[model samples]
Structures are given as structure tokens and as C-alpha cells.
Target: MWSGPRNLSTAMMYAFAARGDCAVWDEPFYAAYLKATGIDHPMRQEIMTAHDADPDRVAAACRGPAPDGQAIFYQKHMTLHMIDGFDRGFMRDCTNVFLIRHPARVVASYAQKREGPTLADIGFVQQAELFDQVADWLGRAPAVIDSHDIRTNPRDALESLCHTLQLPFTERMLSWPAGPKPFDGIWASHWYNAVHASTGFGAPEGPLPELAADYRRLVDQAMPYYERILRESGRNPNSPA
Candidate 1:
């Protein structure tokens, strides 16, 4: 799974982890991204110390067999973390799914966590680039799921997604026990409080939260990229059940 921050990604990871056969990995490239870029993210030092900071090693692991001999390996990836120096070849070996939310929603939610996000910080451009890369490699568009659709009707949305991925839909993907899992990255303390407090997807989001002028401009910069991918993402939360 590939997504930006605050995009229901953690919940989706928990849902997949709830399935006994799947082994989930949370943001494997994050430490490497931070190390390479030297960006001052919250928990930057601790995250680099706790997680492997070598992109090559991380990429190798991603291409390696599922840990502990599990039948499926579900890796939750952040599009922003795939910085320029990182090798993306490993993605060729796995199924790629893009998880997206409206730019207004992403910008609003992200601002509440970390102040003053830019277009790169929120990952709209990187996501579209990655999507196109995968699509080019496969000769077609890859699977995509909107966060709104997942929140609005998780069952129908995930069922459709599972079908696209050729996996059976299980009620296990709908919810999980509240709190952190062993797989969460060390940065979870700074980023995952809301997801940790939940057992499932939250109530469908209310109207897109109002944004201040500068943030609204950021959303505008991100909208074209969001809409480009949304055109390929078949699910619509507002569509009739």
C-alpha cells in the first residue's frame, strides 16, 4: 500500500494484519528517507536509530521472502519517503495499491499534526509519479482506493479492492483491536495517536475542513495530481451503494 500521511493508512495496515496469513510492514523506507534528506521531522533521531536507515538493505528486504514464512507480505509505504536516491526496483515484485484522499482533507489533517506542509511534504506529486511508474511498468494503471470510500463503507470498498488484488475479502480487514501493533515504526508516538485510539475506520469524514489561505494554496497545488490519480481510482464514496 502506498499513501501519504493521515490517509487511513495505519488503519488499513491494522486491518490487513488482522488477517492471520499476512505479515505487515509499516513504512520501511521512512528512516532512509529522513537520513538521506536530513529533514527535521519529529522523532527523526529516534526513528533513524530504531529502524534500519540503509535504503539498499531496506529494498533488499522488501524484495525478499515474507518474514517468518507468512503467505502474504503487506507493506505500508509512504510515497514521500521514496526519495530520489532510493531504488524503486523492489516494487516490481509486489502488488501496488495507491491510497488517496482529497487534497483539502489531506492538507487539513496533516496541518493538525505537523505545521506548514508543502506540496512535497503531503506527497501528491510523488504519488502520481509512482503511480505512473508502476502503470508504465505494467502497461496499465494499478489498483487505487480512496480513503473516503474506505471510511464510508469499508466492506464494499475493501471487498472491491480485494477482488482487484485477487485476494478473498475477509471481515478481518474491517477492524482490529485498538492500540499500536508490534510493527509500527518508532515515529508512531508522534504520528499515530488517533489511529491508536480507534478499533476501525472512523465515522465518514465531515465536510472537508476549512483551510487557511496558504494551506488552501497548497491544496490547490496538490489538486491536479490528486484528480489525475482519482480518475483512475474507480471507487467513489458518494456513489450509491
Candidate 2:
């Protein structure tokens, strides 16, 4: 799945990891992204030291064999990680799915952990770019799931996803052990407290963030990109923004 930071991507990762037939990889290209962009995310030095820093090598590994020879490889990816010059051709080798949340929610959640997140830092522009590129390449829009739909009605949303991806809908995907797994990236320590404490998708949190003036402006800049994606994918029309 192609997702942005703090977009329930980790929860979905846990869901898929629950399936017996599927194996999961959490943000395999993260180290490379941090290395290439020098973006000052939390745990930067720890992340770099723990994984491969070469983007080309990471791409090759992604296109290589599935770990443990599993039947399905569920790669949970961050769209922002695909920096300039990163080879996205390997995307064609697997089914590409996009998972999105409202810009307001994402920006709010992200800001709690880090200050001054730009549009790129939140992954809105990059997600839209990848969505369009994949749509053009496949000559059809790939699956797009709004995070709200998954949180509010997981079975319905996941059933829709499984149909789109041609995968089975397992009850197993609805729940998982409530703790860190072997597949989580090292950076999970800094970012996955909520997910690590959950067995299933939780209730939607209080309200979307009422952003400060600066963050509200960032949200304004991102809304058009977010709406364009919804228009293009034409899914979850009723999902709350």
C-alpha cells in the first residue's frame, strides 16, 4: 500500500500482517529516503544505521523475492519516500494501492510529533503524483481507500480493497496481536505507540485538528491536491473530510 505518514498506514499494515497467507514489509525504502533527502524526521540517525541507505539497492530488493517465500508480499510504503530519481518502474511488478486520510487530520497528527510539516513532509503532493502516474500506466485507476472508511467501517472498506486487489477477504485481517511485530521498521519505536496498543482499527479520534494559522494555511494549500485525488479515484464519495 502507498501511504503517507500518520494515515493509519501502520494499522493497515498490521491488518495485512495478520493474514496467514500474506507477509508484510514496513517502509522498506525509509532509510534510503532519509539518506537521500536528509529530511530531519525523528530517529534519523538510528533509522539510517539500521537499514540499507542506497535507494537503488532498496529498489532491487523490493523487486526481488518475497521474504520467507510467502505467497503474497504486502509492502506498506510511504509515497513521500519515492524521492526524485527513485525508480518507480518496480511498482508495475506488484499491485499498487493508495491509502489516504484528510489533510487536516494528517497535518494535525504529524505536527504533534514534529513541527513545521510542509506539504511534501505530509506526503499529499507525492501521493497525488504517484496516484496519477499509476493510473496512467495501468490505463485504469488503482485502488484508493480513505482512512476514514477503514476506521469507520473496516469490513466494508477492506472487502472493497480485497476485491480491487483480487485478494481474499479474511476475517483474520480484521484483528491482530496487540504489540510490535517482527516486520515493523526500527523507526516504529518512535511512531507506533497507538498501533502497538491496538488489536483492531480503533474509533475515530476526537475531532480533526483545529490548526493554528500557519498549519491551517498548509491545510489550505493541500486541500486541492487531496480533492483532486478523490475526484480521480471516485471512491468513498461519502467519506468525511
lDDT of each: 0.89, 0.87
**lDDT for each residue of candidate 2 in 1-241, tens digit (9 for 90 to 100):** 9988999999998898888888888898999999988888899999999988888888887885788888888889999999999988789898898998888999888988888998889888999899999999989888888988888889999998998888889999999998889889998888899889999998756667788999999989988878888888875544565
Give candidate 2's error at residue 29 in angstroms. 1.1
Please report how far candidate 1 places residue 134 from its true position, in Å.
0.5
lDDT for 78 (candidate 1): 96
RMSD of each: 1.9, 1.4
Each model's TM-score, in the order given?
A: 0.96, 0.96
Range of the 10 consecutive residues with the lowest summed lDDT in candidate 2: 232-241
lDDT for 60 (candidate 1): 97
List model 1 lDDT by residue over 96-125, tens digit each: 999988888888888888999989999989
TM-score of 2: 0.96
